[model samples]
Target: MVLLLFDFFFHPFVPDVLSLWHQEFDFYTLLLSVVYGGIIEEIMMRWGMMTLLVWLFWKVAARKKQVPPYAVFWTAILVSSLVFAVGHYSVTALETEITTPVLVRMVILNGFGGVVFGWLYWKKNLETAMAAHICTHLTMQAVLVISTILS
Candidate 1:
């Protein structure tokens, strides 16, 4: 909700990575984002990367356990989230000047969401994380469409 509100209200000041979707709102693109962004991102970031991190930590650091320790788990989440944030910045890097503020904002916002999704993946399931991510994109798209209509 906070991320949605930030994208809605302060878009002019701190544009989101998907701000282009607002300018050129296409149903197919929105659908693809909701579907693929939710599933694929979770698969890549959490299931793949975070899981790998945990496994590596378990194997290398905590040789006694099959599962990672709490510290290792949290560290994996942070690292995965940072990687996720970096991935989001790829599009922005092509057009905008990647400044300190932009980098900070990207890490803070996207990384926070990534961590939440990562936690969901850890606690519940990958499907839950994917559902949350899909809902987030849908909500953002809905707001963008409505704001466009109003304007």
Candidate 2:
């Protein structure tokens, strides 16, 4: 909910990453985003990257605790989110004619989503995070479709 609101409210009034979303808001694209962005991205960012970082940090930085410390977990979340943001920025740049504002927004928004997913993965299970990710994309697609219908 927070991430959705953030995207809806924070998107630039002028040209930005929303331009890419508006341009590519088709059934196929939506489906791809729901599946790839939700499933694959969660697997990579949360399951793979974040988990690895937590373990590594726990071992190295947190002095090999039996369980990961809070600091270790948070460090993992922040680093993985940064990575996720950079990955999105790189890929989005290739597809869109991104200005600085667009690129920055894309990085920040995706990074915020990454933090959400990472938190979910830590608190719940990977599946829970995956479901949230999928739902986010589906909800966005639904809004786009409804707006198109109304307009």
Candidate 3:
């Protein structure tokens, strides 16, 4: 996975990234993250927010067209991803101070996840995005487990 690659390649130089991701991980938290991050987030973000944006954009920009333009979809994806990235600031701020590096990290990483999920939702369905989100969490958890085992 991309995250694993980031960890594998950059972890030696930037070990703080691992710490920045999560301070604690247990079975319950992992389950909760998968459920909430995967199912709930996809529902709210892709299914709800992105869909809403697409509808609005389609209505305003391409009302007569049967299918929305690619630009509309990209606009919706970018906006929704922006919201998703900013939304993460709340949790990070609650945990610790939101420094410039933290802000950049969350924006790039979470925004990237949002875009991927949004693309899946647009191309496939809500379930596809949900599955991808779940897989992402599982992969991250697997990385954590592997690192814990190694160290």
Best by lDDT: 3
lDDT of 3 at 22: 34
lDDT of each: 0.80, 0.81, 0.83
Question: Against the correct fold, how does model 3 do in TM-score?
Answer: 0.88
What number of backbone clashes does candidate 3 have, counting pairs of residues 3 or more apart or in separate chains? 0
**What would the per-residue lDDT of candidate 1 be over residues 40-90, giving only the tens digit for each residue?**
999999999999998887788898976678888888889999999889887
Off by over 4 Å in 3: 5-24
The digit string of per-residue lDDT tens for model 3 on 43-148 reads: 9999999999999999999999999999999999999999998999887676657676667766777888999999999999999999999999988887778777
lDDT of 3: 0.83
lDDT of 2 by residue, 101-140 (tens): 7667777788888888899999999999999899888877
> How many pairs of residues collide in model 2?
0
lDDT of 1: 0.80
**How far in Å is the alpha carbon of 125 misplaced in model 1?**
0.8
> In candidate 1, which residue pairs clash?
none
Candidates sorted by TM-score, best first: 3, 2, 1
Error of 1 at 77 (Å): 0.7
